[model samples]
Target: MAAAKIKKGDRVIVLSGKDKGRTGDVIQSLPKDGKVVVDGINVHARHTKPSQGDPQGGIKRSPAPMPVSKVAHVTADGKATRVRFEIRDGKKVRIAVKTGEVING
Candidate 1:
């Protein structure tokens, strides 16, 4: 398997879709599906009748998974940047292409 360019907890900016121009932390990463879920982004509502799991299963709002291509990592200066892998001290690390700074997980 290839290394992940984006991972959970990465601060990213939406490049397209209704949430474009918005920035948030990555809530989940679905590398297999090439998708990710960002906090407070791409939210969808689910309405369900009262279910056994919850006595009041009303409208539930939650973030939905979006294609990984739609998002970019945010640098320290708050600008969007592409990610690159680099070998540092015998360890592979992610770097921000724009700022050339190492990104910590």
Candidate 2:
């Protein structure tokens, strides 16, 4: 699998879709699928029947994964930019293409 530019805990901005222009922290990244689950973005309500855990049936809102192509990494200055990988001090790192800040901590 190829390395993903986005990672958990990184702040990102949604580029397209109904959630476009929204920014949130990346909760998870699915590199194989090229999808990402950002906090408070792309939420969907799921209806569920009563199960073993809960007796009452209700609707639950959950975060759905969005395509990685639709999200851009948000830099410290609040601009959305592409990310690139580079080696610094003998360690591989991800950095913002615009600001050149180390993104992967």
Candidate 3:
């Protein structure tokens, strides 16, 4: 498997754009595309036809995928920082650069 710096459920902060400084959990990880969708961030409106769930078919707010460069991993100390890999017990783990703490997926 490829090493993806960010994983699903990771708390991240937007580094730039309209969602700058906003923090949210990673809802999905598009590792192949190097883009992760964060909950409640990068939202965009979508128009859909009437479905069984919603007959109104009004515009719904959905999160749009943003480049991985626009976000950074949030460390345990509540700081946005870069992620690095470290080997421990023969297993590679993601470590937060700011606090040197292991991040669990």
Candidate 4:
């Protein structure tokens, strides 16, 4: 398997699924599973009993992991675009394939 083009903290737009078109920061990336958890997207309600953490037993909303293929990277200009890697200043950098802007640190 190859490394994911999107990393944690990167902004991404949902390309498919219930949250299609919604954009959010990447919370986590699971390359092995080909899934990524985006903030405030793919939310799932989980029922839990009262515990030491929460006395009120109710449904809790949390972001669930979705397939990595379901998302596309969002650029600084707020457009969804493909990514490509390039060598600049003796370092490897990720750039937006559409706008040619460096995306990696």
Q: How far does residue 23 in candidate 2 sit from its true spot (Å)?
A: 0.6
Alpha-carbon runs more than 4 Å astray in model 4: none
> Which stretch of 10 consecutive residues in model 2 shows the poorest summed lDDT?
96-105
Q: Write the per-residue lDDT of candidate 3 for residues 50-79, one digit (tens) a residue.
A: 989899898899898888889999877678
Best of the two (1, 2) by TM-score: 1
List per-candidate RMSD values in Å.
Answer: 0.9, 1.2, 1.6, 1.3
Q: Candidate 1 residues 1-105, lDDT tens each?
A: 788899999999999989999999998999999999999999999998997989898999999999999999999888999999999999999999998999997
TM-score versus the correct structure, for each prediction: 0.96, 0.93, 0.91, 0.91
Candidate 2 structure, TM-score to reference? 0.93
Alpha-carbon runs more than 4 Å astray in model 1 = none
Best by TM-score: 1
Candidate 3 residue-pair clash tally: 0
lDDT (C-alpha, whole model) for all candidates: 0.95, 0.92, 0.91, 0.90
What global local distance difference test value does model 1 have?
0.95
Pitting candidate 2 against candidate 3, the one with the higher TM-score is 2
Judge candidate 2 against the unseen true structure and give its global Cα lDDT, from 0 to 1: 0.92
CA lDDT, candidate 2, residue 16: 91
Residue 52 CA error for candidate 2 (Å)? 3.8
Candidate number with greatest lDDT: 1
